[model samples]
Target: MSDLARPRRSVLYMPGAKARALEKARGLPADSLILDLEDAVGPTEKEAARELVVQTLKEGGFGLREVTVRVNGLDTEWGEADIRAIAAMGPDAIVVPKVNAPADLHAVERLMDDAGAPAATKIWAMMETPIGILNAREIAAATPRLACFVMGTNDLVKELGALHTEGRAEVMTSLGWCLLAARAHGLAILDGVYNAYQDEAGNRAACRLGREMGFDGKTLIHPAQLDIANAEFGPSEADVELAKRQVAAFEETRAKGEAVAVVDGKIVENLHVETAKKLIAQAEAIAKMQAG
Candidate 1:
């Protein structure tokens, strides 16, 4: 699958300090996994978590799931060491936290380069600070290795001094800015995690909102939330059928030297055909990932 088309429908966060969690993650149905060495790890466990995460990556049993390591902020004591260690390991990407500007990414890129990280490993930024939201575009275009934005809504809410309402009214503007930047740069973006893990309805509702807001997927806090994220973000059977119809109808119209076709009483144009084809490709990619 193309890098852009790789399914990120359910990106679960697995605490790097927990060996059982890391082992369990290999069999989880998540489309992507963020092996977290930052917030999830207690301050006393930082070095241990980093070492454990490195060992887990070396073991490498995650089949087809995009694995990324979320390092602590560079300002923190463990951040530099985390980057130097993770960069050398070369997971799919190295996630940087609280990236306030392009300079943060550049700094991390330098550390990555100094560590001799492989070219295949990309960088994913956490858009959590107000300055980061304000400088979304520059961060998105910061480095060639930058490939994704992972929303850190919990930190963002705290940073904004705003409440986390059900509708996320407080953070919609911030989300929009990052989304625009990611799309503008052709990078994948994920929605923040839904905290109410036990509330299936609430989690589903949040996933629906994220999907409607054009998020490629959502960061999940628990394994239980994986199914809902996958279902809400991936193309449904009805959507796949519609895409197939739109593609076929557009081809037929083009054969007749026409510029438009109608599908289900809606006019389909070249732009719609293009979108339909992308949707079809995404669905196929998801299927292939699931099959593996």
Candidate 2:
């Protein structure tokens, strides 16, 4: 969807140590699940969580799900072992925390290769630090194996000493730059989690804003936010209908030796047609994903 490998409209973070939560995630409607071993797991429980996450990936029951493990950083006590274990038991990707530079990605790539991980083991960078956001473009262009950019807004906010407002005014500039970098290199970018799990309306508004800002999806903290995130990020019925009409009109005009067409009094050009086609394709992809 949206030229991304999958529709990440609702990416939920499931605790790596919690068996019940991981089991519950299989039934949730989220597009992807991040089996988090970094922030979610306590220091003492890291080893157990790491082992459990690997076992879950090996067991593999979450159908049509892009399962990934959010590994601890290489700087941590359990980081290297976590990466080695996860690399061996590859999921869809291995999400590393606090990736600040291209060198960081290169280091992980070397580790993954050394571990003899499968070819499909992707690398997802958590853009949380100030340096990461500053070097967003370099980090994105660092490796072909990098697949997605997950906004770690909580850490960023803490780093910047900024408040997480209802509209996310403070972090908009950083988000914009990071998004530009991701798009420049053709990688999917996901908005960070909405901390207000109890506030459904707020979460819905945030998801809408994320979609408008051109994020491929939004990371979620709870199952309750799944529906709202999916709906808000998805193409509306009206949008799909309009895209179809525009594409039809453009094709007809092209056949008549025209460079542009007018659909419903709006000028439709090649760029518009391209956008329309992507929307249509994404809608179809989402429908197929849901049906299965």
Candidate 3:
């Protein structure tokens, strides 16, 4: 599958400080795994977690799951070492925290290059700070190696001094801005984590909202949230059937010198056909990944 279309429906953050969590992550149903070394690891365990994450990357039993490591911000004491070590090991990408501008990505790219990281190793920016949201476009277009955006809504709420209300009104603008930037640059973007992991109804509602908002997927805190995200983001059986019918109808109409077709009493234009094709492709990619 193309990097842009890779199924990231459920990206789970595994605490790098916990050896058992690292081991258990291998069999998790998440489409992507973020071996987190930033907020997930306490200050005292930073170095130890870094070492463990590096070793885990080297060991390599993650099957077809997209593996990434969330490194500390470059402003932090451990950020430089974290990037250098992670870049060399070369997970799918290095998740950089608190990216406030293009220059932040430039700095991370330089460190990655300096460490001789592979070309396939990309950067996932955490879009959390107010400055980051304000400069979302510039940051999205910052580097060719930057492949995805992961929303840091928890920190965003804290930064904005806003409460986490239902529907996430507090951080909606931030999310939308980063989303526009990500889509404008043709990069994949994931929604922020849902804090109330145990609340299945709330979690499902949040997942639905994220999918409706055009997120490729959502960052999750626990394995229990994986199925919710995957079901919400991945094309369902009904969706696949409708996409197939739409594509077939559109092709038939086009062959007859027509510009559009009707599907379930709604006009399906070229743009709709395009979206249907993409959905079909994404569904196929997800199936292939799971089958493998």
**Residue 14 in candidate 3, Cα distance off native in Å:** 0.3
Best by lDDT: 1
lDDT of 1 by residue, 1-292 (tens): 6679899999999999999999999999999999999989999999999999999999999999999999999999999999999999999999999999999999999999999999989999999999999999999999999999999999999999999999899999999999999999999999999999999999999999999999999999999999999999999999999999999999999999999999999999999999999899999998888888
What is the TM-score (0 to 1) of candidate 3?
0.98
Worst 10 residues of 2 by lDDT: 1-10
- Can you write out model 3's per-residue Cα lDDT over 19-113, one digit (the tens) per residue? 99999999998999999999999999999999999999999999889999999998899999999999999899999999999999999999999
lDDT of 2 by residue, 1-292 (tens): 3237478899999999999999888888888999999999999999999999988888888877788889999999998899889999978899989999999888888889989888888999999999999999999999988999999999999999999898799899889999999999999999999998989989989998999999999999988899999899888999999999999999999999999999989999999999999888878888887787
**TM-score of structure candidate 1:** 0.99
Better of 1 and 2 by TM-score: 1
TM-score of each: 0.99, 0.97, 0.98
The pairs that clash in candidate 1 are none
Q: For model 1, what is the error of residue 165's alpha carbon versus the real structure, in angstroms, after optimal superposition?
A: 0.5
> Better model by lDDT, 1 or 3?
1
Q: Global CA lDDT of candidate 2, please?
A: 0.91
**Clash count list over all predictions:** 0, 0, 0
Per-residue lDDT, model 2, residue 172, is: 95
- Clashing residue pairs in candidate 2 (N, C-alpha, C atoms within 3 angstroms): none
